[model samples]
Target: MALHPALTPVADLVGTWRGPGRGEYPTITSFTYTEEVTFTDVGKPFLTYLQRTWSPAGDPMHTETGFFRVAGGEAVEFVLAQPTGQTELAEGSLVTEPRGFATELHSRVVNAASAKIVDATIRRLRLDGDELTTEFAMAAVGLPMTHHLGSVLTRTA
Candidate 1:
Protein backbone atom coordinates (compact mmCIF):
# COMPACT_ATOMS: atom_id res chain seq x y z
CA MET A 1 0.00 0.00 0.00
CA ALA A 2 1.08 3.53 -0.73
CA LEU A 3 1.93 5.83 2.15
CA HIS A 4 -0.86 7.98 3.48
CA PRO A 5 -0.58 11.72 2.87
CA ALA A 6 -0.71 12.43 6.57
CA LEU A 7 2.30 10.21 7.16
CA THR A 8 4.56 12.00 4.75
CA PRO A 9 6.16 14.07 7.48
CA VAL A 10 7.30 10.94 9.27
CA ALA A 11 7.73 8.48 6.43
CA ASP A 12 11.44 8.33 7.08
CA LEU A 13 10.79 6.60 10.37
CA VAL A 14 9.06 3.57 8.89
CA GLY A 15 11.86 1.09 9.38
CA THR A 16 13.95 -0.65 12.00
CA TRP A 17 16.80 1.02 13.86
CA ARG A 18 19.28 -0.26 16.40
CA GLY A 19 22.08 1.13 18.53
CA PRO A 20 23.42 1.65 22.04
CA GLY A 21 21.58 3.68 24.62
CA ARG A 22 22.21 4.93 28.15
CA GLY A 23 19.74 5.06 31.00
CA GLU A 24 19.91 6.86 34.33
CA TYR A 25 17.41 7.61 37.03
CA PRO A 26 17.56 8.89 40.57
CA THR A 27 16.07 5.70 41.94
CA ILE A 28 18.20 3.22 40.06
CA THR A 29 21.77 2.60 39.05
CA SER A 30 22.85 3.93 35.65
CA PHE A 31 23.26 1.43 32.86
CA THR A 32 23.78 0.91 29.16
CA TYR A 33 21.89 -1.31 26.73
CA THR A 34 21.36 -2.22 23.12
CA GLU A 35 18.12 -0.85 21.76
CA GLU A 36 16.04 -1.60 18.72
CA VAL A 37 13.07 0.38 17.50
CA THR A 38 10.72 -0.22 14.61
CA PHE A 39 8.00 1.85 13.03
CA THR A 40 5.45 0.24 10.71
CA ASP A 41 2.70 1.61 8.53
CA VAL A 42 -0.24 -0.65 7.78
CA GLY A 43 -1.65 1.79 5.22
CA LYS A 44 -3.19 3.70 8.08
CA PRO A 45 -2.90 7.29 9.28
CA PHE A 46 -0.80 6.20 12.21
CA LEU A 47 2.44 4.23 12.40
CA THR A 48 2.73 1.25 14.70
CA TYR A 49 5.69 1.58 17.06
CA LEU A 50 7.65 -1.02 18.94
CA GLN A 51 10.85 -0.74 20.92
CA ARG A 52 12.99 -3.13 22.91
CA THR A 53 16.22 -2.94 24.82
CA TRP A 54 18.61 -5.61 25.98
CA SER A 55 21.66 -5.81 28.17
CA PRO A 56 25.13 -6.44 26.74
CA ALA A 57 24.70 -10.08 27.73
CA GLY A 58 21.40 -10.19 25.74
CA ASP A 59 19.00 -10.09 28.66
CA PRO A 60 15.83 -8.17 27.84
CA MET A 61 15.50 -4.95 29.74
CA HIS A 62 12.55 -2.95 28.47
CA THR A 63 9.85 -2.95 25.83
CA GLU A 64 7.02 -0.74 24.67
CA THR A 65 4.39 -0.73 21.95
CA GLY A 66 2.77 2.42 20.66
CA PHE A 67 1.16 4.28 17.81
CA PHE A 68 2.57 7.44 16.25
CA ARG A 69 0.03 9.70 14.62
CA VAL A 70 0.45 12.84 12.59
CA ALA A 71 -2.81 14.57 13.37
CA GLY A 72 -2.86 16.92 10.42
CA GLY A 73 -0.46 19.86 10.05
CA GLU A 74 2.31 19.89 12.69
CA ALA A 75 0.24 18.27 15.44
CA VAL A 76 1.27 14.81 16.57
CA GLU A 77 0.19 12.29 19.16
CA PHE A 78 1.63 9.13 20.67
CA VAL A 79 -0.15 6.43 22.63
CA LEU A 80 1.99 3.82 24.34
CA ALA A 81 1.78 0.90 26.73
CA GLN A 82 4.72 -0.62 28.57
CA PRO A 83 5.20 -3.98 30.22
CA THR A 84 6.03 -2.07 33.38
CA GLY A 85 2.31 -1.36 33.73
CA GLN A 86 2.40 2.21 32.50
CA THR A 87 0.34 3.84 29.78
CA GLU A 88 1.16 7.18 28.19
CA LEU A 89 -0.81 9.67 26.11
CA ALA A 90 1.48 12.22 24.53
CA GLU A 91 0.87 15.27 22.33
CA GLY A 92 3.24 17.68 20.72
CA SER A 93 4.27 19.38 17.52
CA LEU A 94 6.33 18.11 14.61
CA VAL A 95 8.63 20.62 12.99
CA THR A 96 10.16 19.96 9.62
CA GLU A 97 13.82 20.76 9.30
CA PRO A 98 16.12 21.08 6.32
CA ARG A 99 17.39 17.56 6.81
CA GLY A 100 14.54 15.82 8.59
CA PHE A 101 12.17 16.52 11.48
CA ALA A 102 12.21 17.16 15.23
CA THR A 103 9.45 16.40 17.71
CA GLU A 104 9.03 17.00 21.42
CA LEU A 105 6.20 15.22 23.17
CA HIS A 106 4.94 15.58 26.73
CA SER A 107 2.96 12.77 28.18
CA ARG A 108 0.52 12.15 30.99
CA VAL A 109 1.14 8.75 32.49
CA VAL A 110 -1.22 6.29 34.14
CA ASN A 111 0.32 3.63 36.29
CA ALA A 112 -1.15 0.43 37.66
CA ALA A 113 -1.31 0.05 41.40
CA SER A 114 1.58 -2.36 41.37
CA ALA A 115 3.69 -0.04 39.23
CA LYS A 116 6.05 2.61 40.40
CA ILE A 117 4.91 6.21 40.57
CA VAL A 118 5.44 7.70 37.15
CA ASP A 119 3.61 10.99 36.80
CA ALA A 120 4.80 12.35 33.47
CA THR A 121 7.38 12.07 30.74
CA ILE A 122 8.86 14.10 27.92
CA ARG A 123 10.41 12.63 24.82
CA ARG A 124 12.35 14.35 22.05
CA LEU A 125 13.24 12.68 18.78
CA ARG A 126 15.27 14.04 15.90
CA LEU A 127 15.88 12.42 12.57
CA ASP A 128 18.71 13.40 10.23
CA GLY A 129 19.35 11.20 7.26
CA ASP A 130 19.86 7.66 8.59
CA GLU A 131 20.62 8.81 12.12
CA LEU A 132 17.93 9.03 14.76
CA THR A 133 18.60 10.59 18.15
CA THR A 134 16.21 10.48 21.09
CA GLU A 135 16.14 11.69 24.65
CA PHE A 136 13.63 10.98 27.35
CA ALA A 137 12.90 12.66 30.68
CA MET A 138 10.63 11.43 33.38
CA ALA A 139 9.07 12.63 36.61
CA ALA A 140 8.68 9.60 38.83
CA VAL A 141 9.59 7.93 42.08
CA GLY A 142 9.61 11.19 44.05
CA LEU A 143 12.01 12.79 41.59
CA PRO A 144 11.58 15.78 39.30
CA MET A 145 11.59 15.50 35.54
CA THR A 146 15.20 14.76 34.59
CA HIS A 147 17.03 13.19 31.75
CA HIS A 148 16.57 9.44 31.85
CA LEU A 149 17.53 7.90 28.53
CA GLY A 150 19.36 8.97 25.40
CA SER A 151 20.18 7.01 22.27
CA VAL A 152 21.55 7.49 18.78
CA LEU A 153 20.40 4.82 16.37
CA THR A 154 21.10 4.05 12.74
CA ARG A 155 18.56 2.76 10.28
CA THR A 156 18.88 -0.99 9.94
CA ALA A 157 16.30 -1.47 7.19
Candidate 2:
Protein backbone atom coordinates (compact mmCIF):
# COMPACT_ATOMS: atom_id res chain seq x y z
CA MET A 1 0.00 0.00 0.00
CA ALA A 2 1.04 3.56 -0.67
CA LEU A 3 1.74 6.05 2.08
CA HIS A 4 -0.98 8.46 3.11
CA PRO A 5 -0.60 11.93 1.59
CA ALA A 6 -0.72 13.86 4.83
CA LEU A 7 1.83 11.57 6.39
CA THR A 8 4.41 12.19 3.70
CA PRO A 9 5.75 15.27 5.44
CA VAL A 10 6.83 13.11 8.36
CA ALA A 11 7.44 9.90 6.53
CA ASP A 12 11.07 9.72 7.54
CA LEU A 13 10.01 8.77 11.01
CA VAL A 14 8.19 5.62 9.93
CA GLY A 15 10.45 3.06 11.57
CA THR A 16 12.02 2.03 14.84
CA TRP A 17 14.80 4.09 16.41
CA ARG A 18 16.94 2.90 19.30
CA GLY A 19 19.90 4.34 21.22
CA PRO A 20 21.25 5.50 24.53
CA GLY A 21 19.83 8.49 26.40
CA ARG A 22 20.65 10.57 29.45
CA GLY A 23 18.18 12.11 31.84
CA GLU A 24 18.29 14.45 34.80
CA TYR A 25 16.03 16.62 36.91
CA PRO A 26 16.44 18.82 39.93
CA THR A 27 14.29 16.57 42.08
CA ILE A 28 15.99 13.34 41.11
CA THR A 29 19.40 11.87 40.51
CA SER A 30 20.84 11.91 37.01
CA PHE A 31 20.63 8.62 35.11
CA THR A 32 21.45 6.73 31.96
CA TYR A 33 18.96 4.77 29.88
CA THR A 34 18.38 2.89 26.67
CA GLU A 35 15.61 4.40 24.57
CA GLU A 36 13.50 2.89 21.85
CA VAL A 37 11.06 4.85 19.72
CA THR A 38 8.83 3.62 16.96
CA PHE A 39 6.70 5.37 14.38
CA THR A 40 4.43 3.17 12.30
CA ASP A 41 2.49 4.08 9.18
CA VAL A 42 -1.00 2.66 9.50
CA GLY A 43 -2.37 3.72 6.08
CA LYS A 44 -4.14 6.59 7.76
CA PRO A 45 -3.55 10.32 8.16
CA PHE A 46 -1.64 9.72 11.36
CA LEU A 47 1.28 7.64 12.54
CA THR A 48 1.16 5.48 15.63
CA TYR A 49 3.97 6.31 18.03
CA LEU A 50 5.42 4.29 20.89
CA GLN A 51 8.43 4.99 23.06
CA ARG A 52 10.09 3.10 25.87
CA THR A 53 13.14 3.50 28.01
CA TRP A 54 15.13 1.11 30.16
CA SER A 55 17.75 1.50 32.84
CA PRO A 56 21.35 0.41 32.33
CA ALA A 57 20.52 -2.76 34.24
CA GLY A 58 17.66 -3.54 31.82
CA ASP A 59 14.92 -2.50 34.18
CA PRO A 60 11.99 -0.85 32.45
CA MET A 61 11.77 2.83 33.12
CA HIS A 62 9.02 4.57 31.19
CA THR A 63 6.81 4.30 28.16
CA GLU A 64 4.66 6.56 26.04
CA THR A 65 2.02 6.05 23.37
CA GLY A 66 0.97 8.72 20.93
CA PHE A 67 -0.21 9.64 17.49
CA PHE A 68 1.35 12.09 15.06
CA ARG A 69 -0.92 13.94 12.68
CA VAL A 70 -0.67 16.77 10.22
CA ALA A 71 -3.03 19.40 11.49
CA GLY A 72 -3.07 21.31 8.22
CA GLY A 73 -0.45 22.64 5.84
CA GLU A 74 2.94 22.51 7.56
CA ALA A 75 1.47 22.47 11.04
CA VAL A 76 1.45 19.18 12.95
CA GLU A 77 -0.18 17.79 16.03
CA PHE A 78 0.97 15.16 18.47
CA VAL A 79 -1.35 13.56 20.99
CA LEU A 80 0.44 11.59 23.68
CA ALA A 81 -0.37 9.73 26.85
CA GLN A 82 1.88 8.08 29.39
CA PRO A 83 1.32 5.63 32.21
CA THR A 84 2.20 8.40 34.60
CA GLY A 85 -1.26 9.91 34.12
CA GLN A 86 -0.54 12.78 31.77
CA THR A 87 -2.14 13.31 28.40
CA GLU A 88 -0.59 15.94 26.17
CA LEU A 89 -1.70 17.73 23.03
CA ALA A 90 1.23 19.32 21.29
CA GLU A 91 0.98 21.55 18.24
CA GLY A 92 3.71 23.00 16.09
CA SER A 93 5.02 23.47 12.59
CA LEU A 94 7.22 21.02 10.68
CA VAL A 95 10.14 22.51 8.83
CA THR A 96 12.45 20.91 6.34
CA GLU A 97 16.16 20.86 7.05
CA PRO A 98 19.27 19.92 5.13
CA ARG A 99 19.07 16.30 6.12
CA GLY A 100 15.48 15.85 7.31
CA PHE A 101 12.56 17.60 8.98
CA ALA A 102 12.43 18.95 12.51
CA THR A 103 9.63 20.07 14.78
CA GLU A 104 9.48 21.75 18.16
CA LEU A 105 6.20 21.19 19.88
CA HIS A 106 4.76 22.89 22.92
CA SER A 107 2.11 20.94 24.72
CA ARG A 108 -0.95 21.53 26.82
CA VAL A 109 -0.96 18.97 29.58
CA VAL A 110 -3.83 17.30 31.41
CA ASN A 111 -3.14 15.39 34.55
CA ALA A 112 -5.15 12.91 36.53
CA ALA A 113 -6.20 13.96 40.02
CA SER A 114 -3.57 11.74 41.59
CA ALA A 115 -0.86 12.46 39.05
CA LYS A 116 2.16 14.57 39.67
CA ILE A 117 1.82 18.26 38.91
CA VAL A 118 2.88 18.81 35.34
CA ASP A 119 2.07 22.26 33.99
CA ALA A 120 3.57 22.08 30.53
CA THR A 121 6.10 20.33 28.29
CA ILE A 122 8.11 20.92 25.15
CA ARG A 123 9.42 18.21 22.85
CA ARG A 124 11.92 18.74 20.06
CA LEU A 125 12.74 16.14 17.44
CA ARG A 126 15.33 16.17 14.70
CA LEU A 127 15.88 13.51 12.12
CA ASP A 128 19.14 13.50 10.20
CA GLY A 129 19.55 10.67 7.78
CA ASP A 130 19.08 7.51 9.85
CA GLU A 131 19.67 9.19 13.19
CA LEU A 132 16.93 10.64 15.36
CA THR A 133 17.70 13.00 18.20
CA THR A 134 15.19 14.06 20.80
CA GLU A 135 15.08 16.63 23.55
CA PHE A 136 12.44 16.97 26.23
CA ALA A 137 11.79 19.51 28.96
CA MET A 138 8.90 19.97 31.31
CA ALA A 139 7.44 22.08 34.07
CA ALA A 140 6.30 20.12 37.08
CA VAL A 141 6.50 19.72 40.84
CA GLY A 142 6.45 23.50 41.39
CA LEU A 143 9.63 23.93 39.39
CA PRO A 144 10.01 25.85 36.14
CA MET A 145 10.51 24.24 32.79
CA THR A 146 13.92 22.59 32.67
CA HIS A 147 15.80 20.16 30.49
CA HIS A 148 15.00 16.59 31.38
CA LEU A 149 15.97 14.04 28.77
CA GLY A 150 17.96 13.82 25.57
CA SER A 151 18.44 10.84 23.30
CA VAL A 152 20.05 9.92 20.00
CA LEU A 153 18.54 6.90 18.31
CA THR A 154 19.32 5.18 15.03
CA ARG A 155 16.84 3.71 12.59
CA THR A 156 16.77 -0.02 13.20
CA ALA A 157 14.01 -1.00 10.76
CA lDDT, candidate 1, residue 51: 99
Compared with the true structure, what per-residue lDDT tens digits does model 2 show for residues 1-157?
7779998778888999999999999999999999999999889899999999999999999999999998664988999999999999998899988888899999999999999989999999999999999999999999999999999999999
lDDT of 1 by residue, 1-157 (tens): 9988999999999999999999998778999999999999999899999999999999999999999999976988999999999999999999998778999999999999999999999999999999999999999998999999999999999
Worst 10 residues of 2 by lDDT: 68-77
TM-scores of the candidates are: 0.98, 0.98
Q: List lDDT for all candidates, in order.
A: 0.95, 0.94
Reference-based lDDT, residue 25, model 2: 96
The lDDT leader among the candidates is: 1
Q: Native-vs-model 1 lDDT?
A: 0.95
Residue 18's lDDT in candidate 2? 100
For model 2, the superposed segments whose C-alpha errors exceed 4 Å read none
